[model samples]
Structures are given as structure tokens and as C-alpha cells.
Target: MRRKYNPYALPPWLKKSRDVLHQFAIPFCIFQGIRTILFPTAFDVLFLIALVLITVALKIELL
Candidate 1:
């Protein structure tokens, strides 16, 4: 059986960092999206996709 996830079990420092990343995810995604639009490189497109996925995961508490 799989164990239940417990956010409270995370260390204080890790929790703080997670909070910080959670807060920044959206802006980072937006910036990356704009950068991708301007440049349209393969790497930029891939990176923007990854950023969007990460932002979604963070919002849904899956990360």
C-alpha cells in the first residue's frame, strides 16, 4: 500500500523553500512563456512547457 502524504512532516527549511517556489512559479512561467514567444527556440519551447507543468503541479499540490 502507498503511504499517505503529510505536508507537516516536511522540515521547516524545506517547507519555507517550497512556499517560496510556490509563490514564484506563476511569474516564472509567465516570463518563460514570453521569452519563448520572442525567441521560439527548441530549448525555450521545451523549458516553457516544463515550467507550465511545474506551475500546474505546484498549484495542484502534486509537487
Candidate 2:
């Protein structure tokens, strides 16, 4: 059987860090998106994709 997940079980510092990253994920994705649009490089594209996936995961509380 799988154990239930609990955010409150995380340490204070770790919880804070997760909150900070959760807040910043969107802006980071936006910036990377614009950068990728302007430069159109392979690395930029890949990075933007990764950022978008991470942002989605964070928004959905799956990360």
C-alpha cells in the first residue's frame, strides 16, 4: 500500500524553499519563454520546455 502524502511533514526550511520556488516558477518560465522566442537556440528551447514542465508540475502540486 502507498503512504499518504503530507506537505506539513516537511521541515520548516524545506517548506519555505518549496514555497519560494513555487512562486518563482512562473516568472522563470515566462522569462525563459521570451528568451527562447528571441534566440531560438536548441539549448534555450530545451531549457524553456523543462521550465514549463516544472512550472506545470509545481502548479499542480505534483513536485
Candidate 3:
């Protein structure tokens, strides 16, 4: 007998977080990609600073 595929076996929290991350990752990565191609050096520097600010905000929010 073949084993049945299971889609809902994942924990709800894990699934939710994964969905949120996936949503954020798409646009975030797209913008970063476009920024890199259109404005490599300047965008890279600004991206780094923005990333730092985002990390700090996340840390603060989590804490």
C-alpha cells in the first residue's frame, strides 16, 4: 500500500510563521533584487542601513 500524502500535519504556529515569512520574503527579495540592479552601490548601502533598522525594530518588538 502507498502512504497517503499529508498536508495539514504541520503545527499551526509553524505554518502561520512560515506563511508570514514567505509573504514578506517575496516582496522584500524582489525590491532588493530590483534595487541591486538599478542602483547597486547606493542601494546596497541603504539596504544595509534599512536592514539594521528593521532588525532593531524586530528585536525591540519581540522583547
Candidate 4:
């Protein structure tokens, strides 16, 4: 008889990270959805501001 391998198991670190990111993404998506409904035009502005801040932080750390 031959043994079978299973793919259901994942590495500890990957599973932890996946759970944490999933939790964070749910709230983030909800917030953005509400913002877009309230102020459709402002939603883009808010997203751009967040993108700029993230890029700035990355650049600062890289320098």
C-alpha cells in the first residue's frame, strides 16, 4: 500500500499571516465601501492620499 499526501496543512507563519491580513482587509474594505457611498468623489481622493503616504514611508525607509 502507498501513503497519500495531504495539501490541507500550511506552514505556521503563512497561516498566521493569512489570518491577520484577512481580518484587516475586511474592515478596510468595509470602510472604503462606506466612504464611497457617502462621498463618491472623495473616495478617490482618500485613496490617493493613503497611497501617497504609503509610498512616502517606503521611500523614507529605503533611503
Best by TM-score: 1
lDDT of 3 at 18: 54
Which 10 consecutive residues of model 3 have the lowest summed lDDT? 54-63
Q: Candidate 1: which stretches are off by over 4 Å? A: none
lDDT of 4 by residue, 1-63 (tens): 995643246688866765565446545656766777777886566885665554454445321
TM-score of 1: 0.92
* TM-score per model over all chains: 0.92, 0.88, 0.44, 0.41
Better of 1 and 3 by TM-score: 1
Ranking by TM-score: 1, 2, 3, 4
Clashing pairs in 1: none
Sorting all predicted structures by lDDT, with the top scorer first, yields 1, 2, 3, 4
Worst 10 residues of 2 by lDDT: 54-63
- Look at candidate 3 and tell me the lDDT of residue 48: 56
Alpha carbon deviation, residue 51, candidate 4 (Å): 16
- lDDT of every model, 2 decimals: 0.90, 0.89, 0.62, 0.58
Residue-level lDDT of model 1, residues 1-63, one tens digit each, is 999988899999989999999999999989988888888999998998898898898899987
Pairwise lDDT winner, candidates 1 and 2: 1
